[model samples]
Target: MSGIYIHIPFCKQACHYCNFHFSTSLRLKDEMINAICKEITLRKNYLANNILNSIYFGGGTPSLMNADDLSKIFETINKYFQWSPESEITLEANPDDVDNKKLKIFKTYGINRLSIGIQSFFDADLKWMNRAHNSKEALDSIKVAQGEGFSNISIDLIYGSPTTSDDMWKKNIELALESDVPHISSYCLTVEEKTALFHQIQHKKTTAPDLERANIQFDALIKSLTSAGFDHYEISNFAKKHHIAIHNTNYWKGQSYLGIGPSAHSYNGQSRSWNVANNKKYIDSINKEILPIETEFLTPSIRYNEYIMTGLRTMWGVNSDEISVLGDMYRVHFLSNIVKEIDSGLVHICDDQYVLTERGKYFADRIAMNLFFVN
Candidate 1:
């Protein structure tokens, strides 16, 4: 089944570590929403008549949009596309946006899933990240969402920030578990080029992030979540049974999806496309009845690389049979090269597939890169 991803590229404030496309200005809010709705209709045929199984509201901060905005978008989707009664609808929100009133508004819409960005439950770390909410608000948001009867909820957390000690990291996980949320997405804090964090380290204004501490945090996360009976389905995601994010899973599995709004990407099996990242350009282009997107046709080598990269990161592993379907010379190259990896205890050979062991998961990208065809 296909999916839809709508990017709302605006935030109330910029975090020092963010490299995503967003503007702090709300002046363009109404114009942006109109552009997004126009985009939905403009790209309706991109899905190629596939029934949509998931609709994800992702962004600079989807929570920034009020209920009326969400209602109009949902209405447009229902009016234009084929949707299932049980389609998984998810909205990504920040903790500051999840009071009782807002949560009630969310429920009245068709949103069945809520992904709250609660980077950390410690005020010190929150301030370091320039988050809009404090520790109390983080917990309060979860309580209010739960109190409003939202069960399929997920919280995003960041680990290994300079401000997060090992004890504090454990506390953050414990706080999330204690909150009774069913899903959690924990990511290692990284310093991207041109980000404020990067500049700070370059200028010695702040200490560089500790890679060792980050690795330790990841190991601890695995141990703790496994003990808590959460399934480590993806590298950074843990969830109770039946609660893994459907939209993201579809992405990893290479299912077709249409992405609307600025800076969003779409894949329809054989080809991929992406809209312009500039907000004004996106709005102007769409207003002219032109879908401002670039297209790419995947070569076999590109598809193979993508498959290996995504497949080996999950518990499902990469199937040799699937690679074999790509044809013989390619299959021979893969099997022969994988021999060294298997000997190194980095990958295990199952009946007809190869999957990473725990240690291998840490070098997933490196391994996948090595397996890519050089031609």
Candidate 2:
């Protein structure tokens, strides 16, 4: 099944830790939406088959768009894209932008799933991250969405922040569970270059994230979620049975998708393309009838490396038989490389599938890299 992703590169405020392409100013919001719709029409045939199983509205902050703006974008999709009757349409939102009225508009536009960014259920943590929503707003937003009958929901939680302690982290987990959402995506705090958090660390205004505490919090996440009957489907994603995210799971499985708007990336199994991160440049090029994007044809080595990277992080693990598609030589290389890991009890064969053991999940990245093909 195919999927489509449309990036809305606008945010109401800049979070200190975020490095995603977005603008705090709304001066070009309308033009950006128009350009996005045009881009959709231009790249209508990107996916192999015209049938889509999902469409995800992701970005700096998709909820920052007004109801009218979102309506226009969805209208354009209906005008061109042919999706299944059961296609999962997801909108990523921030707590500050959610309310009963807007939630109703989301339903009207045929958005069936909501992924809310409620980083933490604490005002102190929110302020530390420079997020726009408070704890009260976070809780209220989920309630409002549920009240409006939007049940297929996911909420993002951030742990391991400097301001988050074990107690506060537990509270955040409890709060998310209380929201009764089927899915939760939690992540550790990282200081990427060019972010306000990075600057703060360099200037000594804030300390770097503590890896020890982060590891502890991650262990906490696994215990808490699994005990709560949530499947630890991926490194950062957990879901109730049969409620796995269609868009993200498809991406992890190497399925094709089309992405519209600035800074969005699209994959078609053998190649990938990404639009210019600059909004002005993206709009100008689209208006001039030029798609301002760069494309790359992934080599077998590159594709194998990517599959190993994404596959090892999920519950499904990498398919050993599918490795033949990469080439017999590469498949032999992968098998040889993973021998030590499998013997070390970090990875193991289950029936015919390979998956991470609970202990190895903590060091999945290191394990994946060890299996990467270098020529």
Candidate 3:
């Protein structure tokens, strides 16, 4: 099975911390929609003959698109590929854009899952993030989605914001639990380069996110969710039993997926490519029947590094057997290097997997790097 990720690159407002490729204007919305449809038709064979088990509409805000535009995109997919009836079709929406009218249209066109961007249920946090939605809408959207009979829901939350206190962070989790969404994707607020938040820090207009404070919040998040019967399947993600995000899980498992639209990425078994980040350039290229993408053939070392990086972040951990595929030298290097982590109680071998221990979760990236093959 494979997946498709469609990026809708327009947003009503620019969040202070977001660095994802997106435009704040809708002047080219219609043209962009057509370009996406064309891109889908052009890349139909990217997944070969695999059944599409997941279709995700992500981006600036997929909910921003009208039902007609979304339905047309669905039609294009149905024409080109084999879509599984049980496939998990997720649409990432902001709270402000959700409504009963839109919900019915989503159900009619087959959106079984919703990943709402409810970064916070507080007005101050929402304002700080420059989100288009307000507190009332944030609370209403989930109820509205449930009222419309959309069961599988995932909402995002951000932690460690300059304006968010620990008490507020706890309340945010409480709000999420109250909503009873089956899955959640939360993260420590990051100030990425070229974003408004980054510039604010650079100019000393705002202090940088406190790492120590963020760690405390992360620990609290794990404890809270774990006690509430949610699986900490991956860093920054938690879900109820059997309700994990399949699209993201597939990516971590090294499955092939074709990403469409500006700044989208695609990967097969051995190579990867990304479309141009420029909206107009992407549309122009598609109009000319060209894929404005940059490609790379993965080296064994790069692939090995990626496997270690991703595997260490999940509940599944890194499989030692899979490491042997890279070469006997890599296997030896892993065994030799992992002893220190094991001795330090950061990692342990279980069922042929070199999995991180509880304490190791916080330093997953650092541990993965230490185990990396330099040759």
Q: Candidate 3: minimum summed lDDT over ten consecutive residues — where?
A: 44-53
Which pairs of residues collide in model 2?
Answer: none
User: What tens-digit string does per-residue lDDT give for candidate 1 at 1-375?
Assistant: 889999999998988898887888888889889889988987777787658899999989998889779888988888778776588889999888888878778778878899999999999999999888999989988898888888999999999899999999999989989998999999999899978889888999888789899999898898898799898888889999989989999888889999999999999879899999999999999999899999999877778788888888887888877877677767788888888888889999777668888888788888998899877
Q: How does residue 90 of candidate 2 score in lDDT?
A: 97
TM-score of each: 0.97, 0.98, 0.98
In candidate 2, what are the lDDT values of residues 119-148, reduced to their tens digit?
A: 999999999999999999999999999999
Residue 36, candidate 1: how far off, in angstroms? 0.8
Could you tell me the lDDT of residue 85 within candidate 3?
A: 55
Candidate 3 wrongly placed segments (more than 4 Å): none
Residue 260, candidate 1: how far off, in angstroms? 0.7
| CA lDDT, candidate 1, residue 260 | 91
Off by over 4 Å in 1: none
After the best TM-score superposition of candidate 1, give how far the Cα of residue 240 lies from its true spot, in angstroms: 0.8
TM-score of 1: 0.97
